[model samples]
Target chain A: MSGGRDRGPDRGRRRGHSLHAFRAILAKDLRVELRTLQSVPAMALFGVTTFVLFRYGLDRTKLSGGLAAGVLLATVLFAAILAINRLFVAERDEGGFDAIRLAPVDGTALGGAKAAALIVYLVVLEAITLPVFALFFLDSWAGLAPVAGVLALADVGLAATGVLVSAIAANSRARDLLVPLVLLPLLIPVMIAAANAAEPLLAAQGPAYGGIGKWVGVLALYDMTFIAVGFAVYDFLLED
Target chain B: MKVPSLRALSIATILCLGAGFTLVFFYAPLDADQGFVQKIFYLHVPLAICSLAGFMIAGVHAIRHLRSGDPVHDARSYVSIHLSVIFGVGVLLTGSIWAHASWGRWWVWDEPTLVSFLIVFLLYATYYPLRYAIEDRDRQARYASVFAITAGAFVPLNFLAVRMAQSLVHPRVFATTSGGLPGSMLFTFLVCLAGMALLWTCLVCFELAAKSASAKLSRLRRALEGETYAAPNRSRIAPSVPSRAASPLT
Candidate 1:
């Protein structure tokens, strides 16, 4: 970080640096993740564990309709925290993050690629969990759609934030515990959408004239707001 | 960038307090709904708006830092955010007390007002940890700026999201429910907003003065440390900084 020489040419080299940097980071995370497949399995395990808990405690015998929405939202939220914690920490433990930062590159684009990989992993984790959640807890697909949209958009905000926090966690004590301490409080926006959207949809209320639209709007606003914030901050977090 | 003198700010504080209290106690009419409890609106809304405004200033300075690579601007922006977090808590405590008075509940998730304050509380709470977890000064400033800006958007959106949800636990007949208001309430609200902004301007100047003084103190201390500390001209940074203490908040 301290020793690099600043060369004369400004225009061409900087562009090439950005492109190369993005690809390098993307490839590195992908290869490491593909070989070990750590995030997916740990996330899947978390999803399964949540489902098992839901199934064991309230699997129809003890459950009521009013509590269904609240329970499902809690389920997705638990999966999210597990997935985020697993996905971010492993990148540093494997030295993938250090390589990306040490490389001469556009840190934001590198951050962009990391976000992309994270989103892909998250989507797959969600997929694995969806059937499990649907089979055990939720009634149908309608509720899952809005809830999924909320999770997806929230995923970007979380993962973009994950990049910043992951960097901080790397240099801190017990990075694992620190991630959630910093990350969970930021979940207020997510909590509102997931809980609200889940309740109406689980009751099969999606057919209303424009009911789901409001929840969708909430999710979209969260996405747009955080994406802009992430872009502005990514470069700074990468200054090494 | 303009700063009111400390004496002037002190005078302004006295005037705003006198006007705010007089208006609330005597001039403002009792609400058709929540009664005098609604008067809490005079304090809660203005504090929330001011804190949000502070966060926005931090975001703007973050832009300057990212664009021009100016650490001083980064420091100034962080100072604004620091005050914002403190004021944001003031907003939360007032809102919570108002909720207890009006709704007969200390905390409820569905009330947009309660939910909004919780969001403000939680988001700003994250700022300190984010600052403390990092070893890099510039990185802390930058990430905290991103957080400060995101907070600007998140605060309002969270308010809206909680409101849009079905079966709200807290309902208010405040101006937000209806677009505009009676002339007097609107006038009172505007005066409060302007007063709070002025208060923030004064706070920022004070913080900057303290920060500059502290920076000078650190430099002087290092200079006196002599052979133990490297000279500033030749030292680009405190290289390989270990056992160094960082601020709890960025």
Candidate 2:
């Protein structure tokens, strides 16, 4: 299989550097997402519906402090899971994974590209959902700024883990069920840090800034750790 | 490969456990705070530590499996996580008993270690399902290793996050009670920890031996009766022994 490409000149050319491949894959995913409107819009809609459910579920028109933080975090988390579940469906159904495997480009690029795409979906989901969340529950908007920072860091951690897990689940027999079952437990630390950070920011008194830095540090640590792990293990995962 | 001396290990485990229990009940002084109920701590904490160590050790074996492409390492990793999960159940049960005795409740989120342990247990409990969801054996083993490594790394971070979340409110329950332990209590605790570690090792070896024996029996049956007598296995949750390791006669 490697005979034709064993020549020196063709080797470098065939094994095109990962940056180009990464960008190509990321752009392709974005274009498909844009044209299809498959994941982001549905996730946004889910977020809004969940918020309304929480409104009646909690039986409170207004929410603040830990309750508001918990509801908002949980809503975003479930929405992210929806997008994550769909992240690799196209690649699996269509022959995207096989194509990437055949290519000489590094396999980690697929992980990187998929993670980048998931991050975009999360950002868009937050954009649509956070405003609705604030209007529905928050007494004031003072907390929104710091909470956005926390959410953004949390999004990175979510993207790193979601992309890796989505790839693993996509190839499994019970792909749909396996994604959520395995992913939720892995996400507890992220949820813990995000909720803890957002709790004070969404407080009833007027948005305290205390300890946001520590929680953000934890989020960043989790993000970096999983991103490195996903990159290191991506090659092993790709082997037939 | 030569099998380790399971008999000696079992004897050591029994002796250490017996001595540890004697120290707990007879020699060590009762806690001024928790009184007789504090005895459960010696059991719960050691099991908790051993289980966590077992998980990290599984991650190490998984790394070896991936690097060497050796199914023996995979078998070792699987058995380690299996034993750890069993120990995790013990930790949760004993922990619940301690919580009920002290706080009058079966479960409490305020106890960071117990809560973190519950989360860890929930995470590892999915390992069997994850393994079963993959149809291919080689792929199943590889994916399971990846899961083990990821979950292993998550253990410490999960504990840290949970501890941080609870730090502000919960007054470090374990620390306050065991901070300045008397010399006898400390010695007894150390002995119990050693005993629990030995028990974990003995159980892992015992399970591995049983699996190896079953694999060898199947191999013998295949050799004697040809292909027709060998039936396909229906259950996918149990990790398979590498064929080479299973057949000593070969």
- TM-score, per-candidate, Cα-based: 0.80, 0.93
**Could you tell me how far off, in angstroms, the CA of residue B225 lies in candidate 1 after the best superposition?**
8.0
**Tens-digit lDDT string for candidate 2 (A1-240):** 257656686657655667789999999999999999999999999999999999999999999988998999999999999988988888889988898899888889888999999999999999889999999888899999888889999999999888877888888988888888988999999999999999999999899988788888889999988988887777777778
Interface RMSD for all numbered candidates: 2.4, 0.7
> B-chain TM-score, every candidate?
0.77, 0.90
Proportion of true contacts reproduced by candidate 1: 0.65
Angstrom error of the Cα, residue A112, model 1: value is 2.4
DockQ of each: 0.52, 0.84
For model 2 the interface RMSD, in Å, equals 0.7
After superposing candidate 1, which stretches have Cα over 4 Å from the reference?
A1-24, A55-69, A86-98, A101-104, A138-157, A204-210, B1-4, B166-181, B217-250
Residue ranges of candidate 2 with Cα displaced over 4 Å? A1-16, B1-4, B168-179, B232-234, B243-250
* lDDT by residue (tens digit), candidate 1, A115-140: 77878787888778866766765545
